[model samples]
Target chain A: MAQPLPPLSRRRLLRGLLAAAAVTALPSPGGLARAAEPLTRELPGTGEALPRVGLGSWITFNVGDDPVLREECTAVMAAFFAAGGRLIDSSPMYGSSQATIGHALERLEAVDRVYAADKVWTSSPAEGPAQIEASRQAWGVPRFDLLQVHNLLGWEGHLETLQAMKAAGEVRHLGITTSHGRRHEEVERIMRRVPLDCVQLTYNIVDREAESRLLPLARERGIGVIANRPFQRKRLIRRLAGKPLPPWAAEINTTTWAQFILKFIISHPAITCAIPATTRVDHVRENLAAAREPLPDDAMRRRMADHVRGL
Target chain B: MGGGAWWSYRPEDLLMFSPRVYARLFELHNQALWPAQLLALALGGMALVVLLRPGPRGTRLVAMLLAVAWAFVAWAFLWQRYAPIHWGIAYVIPLFGLQALLLVALGSLGGGLRLPGHWSVRRGLALGLFAYALALHPLTALATGRGLSGAEVIGLTPDPLAMATLGLAAAAEPARRAWLLLLIPVLWCLLSWLTLDTLGDRRAWLPLLAVIVALAARLWPRAPSPG
Candidate 1:
């Protein structure tokens, strides 16, 4: 008969075995693979196939004017498109990033392949329409694909205008966003009660709190989701330093850790796409590769979690 | 992290360091390296003078100079990455070779690096310099703050570079002897880097002194000194 064991040790042994099995059976490189024709998932009440990855304009295109900066933004847009990117997220709070994007779109002349997503960064419901209109005017896009109230800025009133814009065919989708782990319950309630097209929030390999609720809610509601701050502001960069990408990661075509982490974030069935903010053209291309392959299954996800956690 | 905090291109970066500072530093050096500074100057001076020595000593000095040269190169090139998060380790002394070598050279000349036959002074004077350098960082930062080159640091604080230089110099043998002669001043300049970048305010770094000392004691346990 097996000797009696303490309960804590038994739990530990089981967790260890489960982790081992998961790592051992990680899918070959084909995991984290995206569709051949730039696969996209449909937004709620909408049939459009959004590209599985977008670009967040937090620190990237936010720097206004500086002609050279505009040129670099254009290159990033071009590189983004080259890598099958479609959705680009921007907001007024980001200091003329939307305006800069408008400048870039005109220069690239490639707005046709883009999804314009901007947010109203104010709290007054009365000014909501004007704010949305300003963003629309700032970007010079005839109709925004999605308009969100950044960080729940306008609460219900901004959402009302976004809803109206959607109904009027002025905007394709009404979405909202929050970050730094705030407003999770609020985001969840919105997903549950209202009709929404997209939701943006921070989700990186380091912060998996969304895995418990928000991501699952998006799937249940059929709302498209976009991940922001997917890098945790370079923490992952330091964590992976001098460490080679796992051989198994090559199965998903990961040449670098950016693709590796992005793949991990987007691999979960709930994550419609991830919008990583990058200033470099090369970085955008690397980020785009996250959309390329089948995500690591539950087991590989655990391994990825373990790897980053230890680092 | 003298990556030195996100300056969106401010003119003050250049203007912040007044010409007076340069003049003052030169004057201070002329009056002679403060005890610690003198110690650093002696080691630095000896290292340079060794280049004029005959044969093997000169060759060794040349090798040491070349080694220090690469350290500076590595500081500027290979390890210049700044991502805010790693600022703790990145700005802490060895984060850059110019800073590290400067400390090491000073440390060797200071009294901390006493060899078996060399004189060893009590630690009081060096400790005082360490405390004074530690206190002056915020004052220096204030001077640089008047003009905004846009360097927005989360905060700045003194780091343990002085203590580290002292500990390392105290632990090496012939090298320790040379370093101890420079220790007081080396310790001061190393702490000076904290003012240059506040050095993480990573209080958790205290344990690092124990780690560095432990590593150095193991690696350079007192070797017999030659005359």
Candidate 2:
């Protein structure tokens, strides 16, 4: 007779279930292949590990009510989860994106696995709560896993509301986001004064303004840094289309230009995760592949930057 | 769709206006150009009356009104504003102007605008299409989630003008001459369908359906001319 099997721990059981789900979520043949065991980073405030690669819904997920396009978006989301992605960031400013995400979630049945991050984007203090409520409804989520003040719009008023919501368990974490390096001083001032769990801003190989101040400050303040525009909205990738990746990219296990650029962002010690939005499944697969082992070291990070700048 | 460096950007990114931004533009256009819209509505009303009771002078006037409307939209919307964001609009402006000039030339040489000699299923369908352009196209915004403020009215916006032109062409006599008039509007419909599809707007199929109905009316066997 076979020896009696040992009882599985709850953590191990959950992992097994997740592994099975990931396998089931794999794309059919002729679709992009899935990545395994995605890399993750710990949130400094809560010490919870989050996948280093996440999806942003700025323009990619704004498909409004077209069944064919929605199906394509569903495929993109399915591929995202299959690669162990969890965080999906959106905002009211990205019109219809939240609604589209809700539609995709309904179709994919992956709501429980999603780490929903949204933003309060209105300028009115009174309107902030209503906007947040609208975003929640659009996303079909009972509560947001992370809520941020988009571009620091009405930051003072919205930050207080986000904090209160977090305390009340309506939001898991409170944060603020900015992009294009706009209002960095004000963002830094807020970061210094407020006890934010996360601060999102644009940081790519070409745009490294965050490295001098925001990244260092986030590190000192124990705030998680979420990097946005990892590909600079496809500008960097487009600029380097004909150029071949340097042999050094192999050290970080990067193949495509997208991977090279994303690895550069996430390799930074300050960045907890980098959210890159794409409408194509192949692109999503390529993006998530950047989250695998052998991220660039400090010297390699510098080399990555220099390589792009030279190109 | 993929070729060269141009394919590097997604089709949606090429759109200068988001749906909200596009709606806001219509709002601002309507607000700033107030009573002008009322005047355009009056022209559309006149055109409908002429369409019902065909006459040479009334037909010429309707064609002139369409030409003026297309020219106005080309200047006011495409050339001045939309071109700033979408560089392709500069090329599109010329096409609108060309369509307007075609209408002007056709209106000046006046036999093609006469309605079909007899009433039939084909004629009724054509009339319905024209009526849809005038009476129903504006209301489509409601179903499309764009609201009444963003509605593209006939004799005011490019879409309804293109749509109404096809409807008018389908109802007119001499299939071969009408086919010449159908060319620009059909092209516009296809272009609009592609752009709207890229934006994921539900109304993307509207132009396509209009094209199909227009083609059916054009090809439908005409009731034998009255003896």
Q: Number of the top candidate by lDDT?
A: 2
Give the Cα error of residue A201 in candidate 2, in Å. 0.5
- Tens digit of lDDT per residue, candidate 1, span A1-311? 99986667654554444334323322245642333235576665588777777888765665434455666677777677656678999886665578778887765565787889888877788987887788888787888888887888767888887787777888878888877566788888888888888888878788777888988888888887788878765556867878887777776667888888888888878777888877787687667666765668889888888877776
Top TM-score: which candidate number?
2
lDDT of 2 by residue, A116-154 (tens): 999998889789999899889988888999999998888
Candidate 2 residues lying further than 4 Å off, grouped into runs, are A1-35, B1-227
Candidate 1 docks at the CAPRI level of: incorrect
Q: On residues B1-227, what C-alpha lDDT tens digit does candidate 2 reach at each position?
A: 11224445567655544565455556656666777777877778888888888777877788888888889989987765455334466778888898888778876584746786467777787778888888888888888676777778887777888888898888776666678788888998998898889767888899989999999999888788778
Name the lDDT value of residue B3 in candidate 1: 19
lDDT computed for candidate 2: 0.81
**Each candidate's interface RMSD:** 16.3, 12.5
TM-score of chain A of each: 0.85, 0.89
Task: Give the DockQ-based CAPRI class for model 2.
Answer: incorrect
Candidate 1: deviation at residue A18, Å?
50
